[model samples]
Target chain A: MKKVAIFGLPLAFFLLAAVFLMRGLYSNPAERDSTLIGQPLPPFQLVDVMDEAIQYRNDALTGEVNLINVWGTWCQTCAVELPFLTQLKDQGVNVVGLYHELDSDPAFGVKSVDVIRTEITEMLKTLGNPYRFNMLDEGRRYSLDLGVTGAPETFLIDKSGKVRLHHIGDLNQRVWQSKFARLYSELESE
Target chain B: MNFRSFLIILFGIILYSVSHSASSVEEKFSFEDESKRALFIELGNELRCPKCQNQNIADSNAVVAKDITAKVYELVKDGKSKDEIISYMKLRYGDFVHYEPPITPLTLWLWLLPLIFILFGCVFMFLLSKKKQVDISQEQLQKADEWLDTK
Candidate 1:
């Protein structure tokens, strides 16, 4: 009994540690709950990417359920997912683009608005525009406020403007079916 | 070369490399108050970059890290306290933004597990020592005494 107890205790500990370490190996480090989930969209007054004269506020997105996609022309994944997002938009989903500009910093030599507009137009014309309207995230302050780590993230906002979900990577059919579709339907019903 | 001269050369090389790397990325932010500048640097060290998992905001070249470092500079310049800035970041990015994790129910085990392991080890060692002492019988003690006398 004593020998068994002595051997079993350490064996149990080793097994437990092995299981924990093995789980860590498979777990995605980037996967974490967003702090802004269940919170209202952060207040912002930003101009449209196409036309700076047209401004948008937090209330602009509150009237209905919307998918705010954080994307940039530079992001390859964003380009790849553009068609899928456009498909969602065509299927009566309100898809808004949050333009996460990379070269907004003056220190890094900022791009002119005309240049950015041309690039956006060229990209959207080629990839099919998924956005209802693109809000220019100048300096990426609004993106930062939205807890955005990088481009290619998407946030699902309900009718009341509460953030329902924040997905970090590209949104595809598989992701939509598994993560977004059911909850989105539930929100639509609500 | 002699061992001492080799070590000196190695130490000199290490020092030169460190100074060279430190001068490579010189971000100039002039502050009126030296203490605020220090605070800004301190906050940069404490704030973890969200995009790059392991690197601090100061060390990471990720765009998000640059945004965060800029924000930290702005907040520090605005005279926000350390805790206020930390909480502000926590609001946006959750507790993961900060290097020091709060001791919650889930994280409490991180602190408790080491103590538990030490206690168990102590108990196991105590039991083993006690068993060793108990294994010395009367005949063994008599034999030891005789051996000592002869010696």
Candidate 2:
């Protein structure tokens, strides 16, 4: 009985606690707050992947309604959505990208360098470098500021540099049709 | 309680059960070889379910992964090699499909952590065991002296 109480009870408590913690993380934020929507974009500088001497920063784009896609060459989901994002951009949707955690080796997970390089090259060939000026932040400082936890997350920053809309994961043709239309209407109203 | 009546009642129950059929949408794929099925599951457990992004295919609730697994069951039942199926999946979904993704220079830490932890645990356990196995010579001598005095 003593052993059961000592071992079983704590084990049950730990399991319950873990379940709750995961539940909380998965849940959306209770309140809808977009304080950053109208605020100036954060200052950041990153080395260009194409050239070592070329550095890109947010200072270059002072005021433009741009889409900053948080993506990585190593992410499979990012590759899945890359073509759609390019299509949207081709349709004249103002879009830029913060190549989150590029340049440096991925911190977690196991992926062969040869495979990753091949995938990235393929991605570049298809996407045709979507960013007006792409920047790579290995530490993910900018991504965290926008509350991005995953890749293929898209942030729509209006002319004022405030994040207007945040979309997570692959934006299919159907989703882009509706979402981008709404973005356009919102811009016209302003 | 009568034999004739009891048989009639049993037949009626059977007819009712047969009428209220459970038509499952689930596809039936049976395997003759136990080892192949086990291997499929072992391979399944090593692949991440694309729909349930965070979980291994075998551990996910995603119906897509379940469908893929059912397909794998069918193909394996039809006698496909393990390497062939794994390569097929990798081709379709990239290297992220592998649950324990191959350790590359970038992913060195994933492989290194377990080794480091085991080494640390061994050293810790060794020190703990040494501490536990104390020399009883002093305690025995003192107890013996006390016993002699009491006598």
Candidate 3:
């Protein structure tokens, strides 16, 4: 038994190290459990993207299950996911666009509201509009509050406005089915 | 161009670029007080950029980093303490936002594993030396002495 242990111990450690490294090779560095999961949506009162007259509060997202998609016209992935998001919207999923404006920074020269509206209208017209109504995250303050790192992130908010899931990449059918669909139904049932 | 002049030009360009990039971050965030400015800089160094892994928020030019920096400046101006600001960030972005990870059950292994490895290595080395000592008996030593005398 001592001889077996002497021979086997280093081999066991070698195997463990090999397994650990192998798992690291496949593990995604960008993927992390969101701290905001199980937390309610951050309070914000922002105007609509197209119409400044209409304002949306955090309470607007309550009373229904919704997907708050953080997207910008400048983001390529957002355009790619637009059709799929529209499909989800068509299927009765409450899809809300949290419009993340890239040029909102005054130092970098801010775009006029009319110019932004025109751009959004053009983009949404070309690609199918998924959003019931897009909330303009003015100066990206709301996105910061939501811990949004970049565009094409989605937050799955339940009926009570609690964020159930925060997906960092573009939303598609596979991701929806695998990540969002079951939890969505579960939240609906609740 | 001559080699010496070309080298000088290259060095000048590098210096200019470095100074230019440094000025960009400096001009963006400013505080009325020196302490607030110091706190802002410290927090920026401690906060990890969520978009770009392996870079602190101060070092990254990512939009998210800029947003966080802006927020940090706002909080500092509001008289929020460093711990309060860090916890506020942690609340939204998780422990990954900060450079110093919290000691938790899962992360405790990171600190413990290295110590455990050292302890095992020390034990193994001690046992190896003990085995060597045991293998060389007094009889073997006397035999070696006798053999040397005979030689």
As for model 3, its CA RMSD to the true structure in angstroms is 3.4
- DockQ ranking from best candidate downward: 3, 1, 2
Model 2 misplaced stretches (Cα beyond 4 Å): A1-35, A109-119, A127-129, A188-190, B1-151
Clash-forming residue pairs, model 1: none
User: What would the per-residue lDDT of candidate 1 be over residues A119-163, giving only the tens digit for each residue?
Assistant: 999999999999999999988999889889998999999999999
Which 10 successive residues of model 2 chain B have the least lDDT summed? B21-30
For model 2, the TM-score of its B chain against the native B chain is 0.51
TM-score of every candidate's chain A: 0.96, 0.68, 0.94
**DockQ (CA atoms), all models:** 0.73, 0.01, 0.81
DockQ, cand. 2: 0.01
Candidate 3 - CAPRI tier?
high
lDDT of 1 by residue, B30-98 (tens): 689999989998999999999999999999988889998889889999999999999999999999999
Interface RMSD of each: 0.5, 14.2, 0.8
Put down candidate 2 lDDT per residue, A123-159, tens digits, no spaces: 8787665566566654565554454545777777776
Docking class of 2: incorrect
Model 1 lDDT, residue A73, Cα: 89
Candidate 1's docking class is medium
lDDT, candidate 3, equals: 0.91
Q: Candidate 3 on A1-190: residue-level lDDT in tens?
A: 9998988998998999999999999998988888888999888999998888999998899999999999988899999999999999899899999999876658555788778778889999999999999998888988888889999999999999999999999999999999999999888888
DockQ versus reference, model 3: 0.81
State the lDDT at B48 in candidate 2. 72
